[model samples]
Target: MANSEPGLADFTKHLRKWFETRQLSSETDYSEKLWIDIHTLFQVLAKGIDSTNPFSEAVCEPDNPAWTLRSHAAEFKVCQRIVNIFLFMDGLHYVNNGDWQQRYIFNNEQRLEEYLRCMLGHVALLQLYGDNCDHIELVRTVSNSMDPFREAFRHADISKTCANMNYRNIQIGTKLIGLTMARWMEQLKGTRHVGSITSDKPVQICNQGQGTNTKEATADGVRQNGHMPIVEMMEDGTTDVVKKLIKKGKDMTDEVKKRLIETVKDSTNPEKTMEDILDTVSKCTAPGNACVQSALESVHTSVTPVPPNPADHDPSAISASA
Candidate 1:
């Protein structure tokens, strides 16, 4: 834990430098140094998240000056998670620019789709941190900033219109971190003092996941089938949540499938047969449907949209596609 002391110090230092400098600057600065700074800052904060409690207060050193945004570990951690996603998706927007599109159009037409998926993942992760007012405020800010991206993604000709239109999307993303820090500063101005050298919040492991207590179950350090509770898992390197369903190698039997179809039929409109439901599902699952594509793209950035083949849409196509 003490090893994190220097890292935390470095984080606070760079954070102050980054915000104060950016606040004073008038122009949009996207230099290599700028990105390197962002990368370094995000790395440090992310590392701290693994070693420190995100929701805990960062106690400052007695003699050190106060830092605004570092008031809570979660503030910077949430910032890192959301901003990193924006930056990663920045490439898609950049490449979509009219000037670059001619020469660097995606091999497929799903780049915007992929970016939306990253946004969803960012939102989902934010939800896991619990809804503190600060977190709510952060989410609201992000939602407002992302409105344009969402609107652009839903356009009829999204691929043609979704170039982020003059770096607007990335600019919004850039301002988000600064805006978040500013809000924190304004809120804390006369209220309380923050510390530069801070102690991490104590970890509290308790009942979680389906609201069940696990303290007594693990009192003797016994393993529950060699698996720690999901609540104990850290976000770093946690890819299981993002895994693609197809890769799980699970299959649905025809009988079970028929039962599900019957259930759906019985529950809603009995007049609508299994074929009707399959038709609707198939259409939604089609790679070319804008709504379907938008959702799929928002979740899986790397997934290429397969071109629709006429032959693949036959009556049995539903089962075959599944």
Candidate 2:
């Protein structure tokens, strides 16, 4: 049966209360934030649904919970529906800026750095509904890209007298790094995207760091999913996307650094920005075999340039004679 009444999204707030009352977690800040983000995304989608198309009719709600989203058109729709909710919530400012890096969600003083860290990490959870965990890697890779931003937070001069939020906020930094765990697992599921980039160019890669350490040796690097998609298999792999997006007029900034780092963090909370992310990216050295732009550029240049010919000798010309 369809949820005819469309149970109010207040479900998020109530869920948090339930967790809190049982002392499962002290306060439901993380869970409540998810509710807020999902609800916000739903409202946005709801408007589009009412004005143009009804989602309920197009997207089926299957009774099977174990089925992968790819199993059926309806399942994927529902999965994408849930993913869209999170994307809309997290995208409020960056989406408006026309570039992912322009928004400074975390740099301001007088902020809840740790709480925001938790929230960013929680956003990764949005992958749970998908047929692909590549999104998990996508999220983690995005988080790693924002490491420099978190590093900025870690090294940022907080007041000596700033009150502690009951524990050392180092949790935020570790939490940001912990995003790689999801990335590793996400890679197991893999990802795929279809687009055109023959005319695309690589955005100029810059060293935003004044020089700082964000985390211990880890796999993620400065390039958020914005710069490069993780575990890709392109004609040139991650290098191609970076080159294309850059050519498309993408800009780089410290805030972009922050968002990239945050992307790898958890998706438990949908709206919060973690400061340690800036600091972490600033500090951590590239993990084993990590591919930064410079590396990609080197490989791109080393490939023997193919001469243009009218023969069209590759697979395109493979007719019945093949």
The TM-score of predicted model 1 comes to 0.26
lDDT tens per residue, model 2, 224-289? 223222222111122233222222212334444343433422223211222223223223345312
lDDT of each: 0.29, 0.28
lDDT of 1 by residue, 1-322 (tens): 0112332233334333343444333223323334344444333323332232211112122112343555654355554444333323332222322221211122332433333223322323322332233432333344334435445544222121212111111212122222122222233323332112222321123223535444343322213322111212112212122121111112434444334333332333322332243333333433323322233233312222334545321211111000
Angstrom error at residue 273, model 2: 24
After superposition on all C-alphas, the RMSD of every candidate to the true structure, in Å, is 22.2, 24.4
* Window of ten residues with lowest summed lDDT in model 2: 313-322
- Candidate 1 yields a Cα-based lDDT of 0.29
Work out candidate 2's RMSD over C-alphas.
24.4
